[model samples]
Target chain A: MIFIKILSILVMLFYALGSAGVFWGIPAERYKILVLGKFFTWTGFALHTLLIISIILLNGADDLSRGYFMQLLAWCILLAYFIGWRLLKSGFLSLTASPLALLLFILALKVDKVQIEMPGTLKELFIALHIGPMYTSLGLLTLAFGAALLFLHMDRKIKSKTRLTEFDRGLPALGTYDRINHLAVVFGFPLYTLGIAAGFIWAPLTWGREGGILGSWDPKEIFSVFVWFLYASTFYLRILRGWRGRKAALLILFIFGISAFSLLGVNLFMPTHHSFGSLATFTA
Target chain B: MNKHICLVGLNHRTAGVEIREAFALADAGLLENGLLPVGAHLKKDLPIKEALVLSTCNRVEILLAGREEKLEELAIRSWAAARNRQPEELAPFVYVHNDAEAVKHLFAVASSLDSMVLGEPQILGQIKDAYKDALRAGSTRFILNALLHRAFFVAKRVRSETGVASSAVSVSYAAVELAKRIFGDMPSCKAMLIGAGEMAELAATHLMNAGIKSILVANRTHERALELASRYHGLAVPFADLFAQLPEVDIVISSTGAPEAVIRAKDMAGVMRRRRNRPMFFIDIAVPRDVDPDVNTLDNIYLYDIDDLKEVVEENLTQRREEAVKALAIVEEETLNFCKWLESTELQPTIVDLIRRSEAIVREEWTRTSKRLRLSEKDTRALELMLGAIVKKINHDPINFLKNRFEEEKDGQYAGLLRLVFNLDKKELCPRRTREHGSEEAPPPLGPPDGGMIPPRRTPEPAAAFFNRIKEGSK
Candidate 1:
């Protein structure tokens, strides 16, 4: 576990350096820095993988708590960046996603202060199915959010008539970034829908429908729906109303903010099965 | 004899177009005839070994490699005689580069670092063409072969590794680039050329290259429109059918030499209504302004005038200048590398002579041992192979050391000492045997050496304006 913690910190530092190096003025140094960053990141990823495998082997799936699941979210985000870096041929995507992954890894290290137990029935394949799609979609949406932020930054630079810096030049084409944003939304929204459906299906099985399958209108569940609607509206506005460019970037930015709030904030304040009993428990 | 490289040239900065044009060779015959007249005269009157003449619209340069110590006067005199002018008349405009400076100048020129429009890529192609002419005329050999090939490589490196040429500097290119931002990839969009003028044709060329699906040429003269349409592989619509084609095409590039507006705001409102409000890009490049400024106010209609494009061009030029700083660094790095290689070549004669002497001695020793041992033919062959391997391994370190370092005056003295100690004949040290023996070994191919110091290969796409790139990114 200490090894894993050390590796995660190293990953954070490397990712920071890599992101910074992409904007380096000298082309030669920029290449060297980018390569070094990748080397550290890959090494850290290996250590992280070993840590996860060891945890799973020692504790088994039942001991795979929300904290571990959050660590898995961090791993998934790194994996997505590696995949995106290959497919898009842009280092900027990795630069954008790395900090988010670092944040998740740090969160994973933090002690889970709140602990309320979930029903034993909730530990089935349905739970894994629900968590998998939810976290993966979250990772995908995070990528879209990263691209949207870059779009906004570049757009702002152009609008304000500020001279574009070397950092701005390193970003992918606005259209390419926008398409990446659209693609992440297109792929994530459906998976998120699946996760929500799986949550509803498991709700009845676990809770026995005594207080209603939705757990008596849980606040976390309501906010999750709110988060879903925000992202869903991005597609609706994009496909139907032809909202694109800056307008679409703005909408995705908002959706990402709300999704982050729903995922982290709701978990902290509201008691629900969606938190897997790791977050704060509210008493009426 | 030490062959010195020199460049005597005049560009837009050093000379006016009139002066440059007077010295420039405007015909392919001048190249094939074994000269630009100046090159031929230099070959005849001076100790010139090889020469290449790079003549573009903006400049005329005579790049020479030879034993001539006083090449500037010879080059200037020949240039003046060829142009039927006095040597003193052209002396003020001509500038000279010697040896390393000459190599640096060639690298800069080939990389477009020395171009009037800082990072335009056409200069590299022009350099390539000149090199090809020199090669065809049998005027480029040994030193030039290495230098010219390195120049092309440097150009390729500068282009791929820097953003120098990644922005449009011309108004026509800016218009097309802006159009791309409005309508992504414009390949499926129909574009109408509103006039058959030069600016319109240039814009149409840029648009066509950007992959517009179709083009419609419209002019007051039906015949002129037909001529322009055929040239661009587009349909020529009659002037009367302007409104009919206007509603169909998504992009309108109007450069008609009109005194008044060719497209009014009222006309665009109806066109927008008829087309169901699909986005339209109007590039008004005409001076008196072919499209009314008010059309820009209409919903779904984006109108950019000549001045707007000029502003884009200016911004792009600014960006290109920023990129050129990186590009010139690449050029300087490549220039140093080429100079190192040239310096290494100074050690080549000694290296070649040393290897030959070693090979002869090894053969003699092998024969003596074989005869004494009375070894079988197969055993003797094995021994010969082993000895050959030993010789290669022995030479590898010295060869690599000399090739990698920029050999200085001390290194040259070391080379001379080695030759003298080995009792090597100066005749055996003559590396230019191809010239002496009249052997026709082809010059090195005009590109980067295989597996050299260049970074990994990247597919070089045509340079696009940075504004369009950002605009598309914002999308």
Candidate 2:
């Protein structure tokens, strides 16, 4: 079992190395090499998800929110990465995703901060409400936030009227970057809504049937709704007045920051019902 | 005296831009003015088969492929007439090389070795345009076509394999880059070329290429200013109008040989007031300087003198002749290989004619023998077929052998030994296109070597020679 884990880790590392070579090395248009590298990365992701599913099934998914959170979130990001790369025709997708995935994979292997305790009858329901949507929301926010940063940098450079380097002229136009950021926010909004709804649904069943456990005052609940509203309004205003520029973009940038804190930042260094008891995770 | 090649060339490295333009084939049809005399002379003596003239700012060259001794003189007159001078006047300044030297000259010109700016790619493009004109005149053929294709490839190789074109730290390049950093691109801005010096001419050249519009050149010498402005089709103004025009032109480049500052802060104060909030690029390349240092005190005016421009030129990350070394190495390697192949091709037709003639005599003898003996139809057909197969089989080996060796060896006499070995030489004896020396033994590889290490196969037959190569590859 230990040996299998080591082999899997090595395969993931090879995928990252190959991805770096194609992205930043000799830069040949290697069709076969590209397909093969993507295959290894996806296969590693699949194995990682499978191992988490098996562990949850054996040990039970009662209070396993953090354990499942990191595992499922890494899986979701990889999922979105593959889909976005295919649909968007973006070349650097693998290059960016490789570093992010490698970090998450290392974190999953070593971080032992998750424990799940649940009643037998509500175990299946609890897992869905607690673990699934939160990870999905975090994945969506990660992509949206990355796109926003790229948009801001490109906008600043273009407006300054600086000389375009040989390579700078080759990048996609500022408007294209801005549009992609808007699209990422539009895509992420529903995932955030689903995560907030799941949190509310699981709160009553786990802590108490009183809706008092997950109230509007809870920082997680309040921030989640605020984020949903911010993105939703931005989406409508963009279509109504064609308001998509630096002003609208800066607003989107703030929303992403809020979304990140609500997902993982709030859980850390804070006392809240969101921080249920399962912290210590599996041993190697 | 046949149509080989006649080169009368002048380029940037050989003459100044003024001299180049003086002799430049400016009129569209000056080629006829140049090549017609060569053509008329070709009619009298070894004739000019075809002619083409390529004239650009960097080089003016006439490529004549004809069969004539006096054709070079005729080409010289053609150039003189274009320059409005006598042949005697133009003769001293020109180089007239023929045959392989002329062939090599045209190749080098097309490859841009003859360019004013060594290894400039514009000459290669100009050469292609020259070839296009030659096509319309119906003078382009196998020899010229092969030469041009090989020349273009050689240019590509020279660029890739050498650094001869790498270190072009020109003033215009520096100006373009600095302007870009300030304004991103100059397409929107108005460009001003102040003074008619060489630096001004170069800066204007760069600006025009960079797509800067509304150009105006101000100089104390109005005619010199006008002459420089006319080249790029720009406007000219008197030196007194420098301040008045500075407000209209966004970019100002001053390159006069002035001893002191020409445009002072007090002078630009009135012009800057009317300009409102526009950005100005001041490139001062004058030796003693042109724009006053105090002018930079005003907002939105970027100033750079010759020293500053030189600093920028020094800092260019790209080396101009970086590719030239690698490109020239490739050019030399490829040229050697190509010339070798060309020499081998000259021997092929003569060898083929010898064999075909041999085969004909055999056929004629077989028919005559069959007719005299009154042989049966079946016997006659079988005999004819059998004899034909023997002849073909005998000739096939040497033909394939000689053709393969052609690529490796340039000299034909080495490979033409097949003609002697086959004994297809006597006319009456062979009864076909035959050589006189049918009975002589096959020729040696190195012209009867001075008793050097004898050919490994100082043996009986070529089959032994075939085994030697197979054994060598195995080893």
Best by lDDT: 1
- Which ranges of candidate 2 are over 4 A from the true structure? A1-13, A19-95, A105-169, A202-284, B1-8, B26-51, B64-78, B81-84, B91-125, B150-409, B419-475
DockQ of each: 0.11, 0.09
Highest-scoring model, DockQ? 1
> Candidates' TM-scores?
0.77, 0.53
Query: A216-267 in candidate 2: lDDT tens per residue?
Result: 3666666667887887787676555345545556776687678657645664
Model 1 clashing-pair count: 6
Task: State each candidate's clash count.
Answer: 6, 39
Cα lDDT of model 1 by residue, B1-475, tens digit = 2557889999999999888877776463444554343333234533666678888999888888765576777767867777778989999998899988899899989989889898988898899999888877767667787899999888888888887887778988877766665555577789998886778789888888888999999989989989888988999998988997788998898888889998899888777666755668888888899999888766556788877777778887888888888888887787788777676666666677678888888988887777779888898788889999988888787666655542444234445435444645433332456544432443222122222232111111111222244468899
Tell me the lDDT of model 1 at B327: 82
